[model samples]
Target: MKKLLVITCFLLAGMGFANAQQTSPVWPGCEDADDVKKCFNQKLSKHVQQNYVYPKNEAGEYVRGKVTISFQIDENGKVVVNSVEGAKPKVNQAAKEMILKIPEMEPGTLNGEPDARNFTVPFNF
Candidate 1:
């Protein structure tokens, strides 16, 4: 019983430590600015708007769909697409391409050390 209590305390303390140390990656130009997270999100939205092209079907009609894209900013500051959900294949491909074009950023940190972090965005057309 005493061992179990000690393990529980350790686990809770670890969770708090992890949460306290988590930090989001900063976009290229926002590295030194205040509000890094807001800057990162704004840049991300602008990037998608500038680069994402909704694919057209064989009939030459634009495919209207929403895609939820998941990607990771790796320790090297490169975007690595993990998955795309809820879109046609062409739309998914477009989403992936746009995400891949994200410029290298300063990777996120955990406990003051670089860490890979996942980000998700939804594209609606």
Candidate 2:
């Protein structure tokens, strides 16, 4: 029975350590949020809406397309655009600009150390 108890204690401690290994990046205002992930998503959507600018063609018509942006928050909490893919160059540029406007926040963690986090977002214009 003593041996079994020792094994169980070790297993519990290992599980706790594993749970602390990874965490999502925290948005500036979400430090006290109940659900950090949801708060992050809300802030991201708001940022996109506020910064998005419609692109226009040379003929003066609005350019419409879907853009997929892949970005990362580095260990220093800086936003870095990895790639922007879209149907039109103007749309891709617009998406990249909007993403680049995101404010720096706390970096995520992996294995209890600051780590980079990647995200992929889609936008339609």
Tell me the spans in candidate 2 whose CA falls farther than 4 Å from its real position.
1-20
**Per-residue accuracy of model 1 over 48-111 as CA lDDT, tens digit each:** 7899888898899988778899999999889999999873888888888888999998899888
Best model number under TM-score: 1
Query: Model 1's lDDT to the true fold?
Result: 0.87
**After aligning candidate 1 to the native by TM-score, how far in Å is the CA of 32 from where it should be?**
2.5
Report the number of clashing residue pairs per model: 0, 0
* Native-to-model Cα distance after best TM-score fit, residue 104 in candidate 1, in Å: 0.6
Candidate 2: deviation at residue 9, Å? 22
Cα lDDT, model 1, residue 49 = 84
**Candidate 2 accuracy as lDDT:** 0.93
> Candidate 2 vs. truth: CA RMSD?
5.1
lDDT by residue for model 2 over 14-64, one digit each (tens)?
Answer: 998778778899999999999999999999989988999989999999998
lDDT of each: 0.87, 0.93
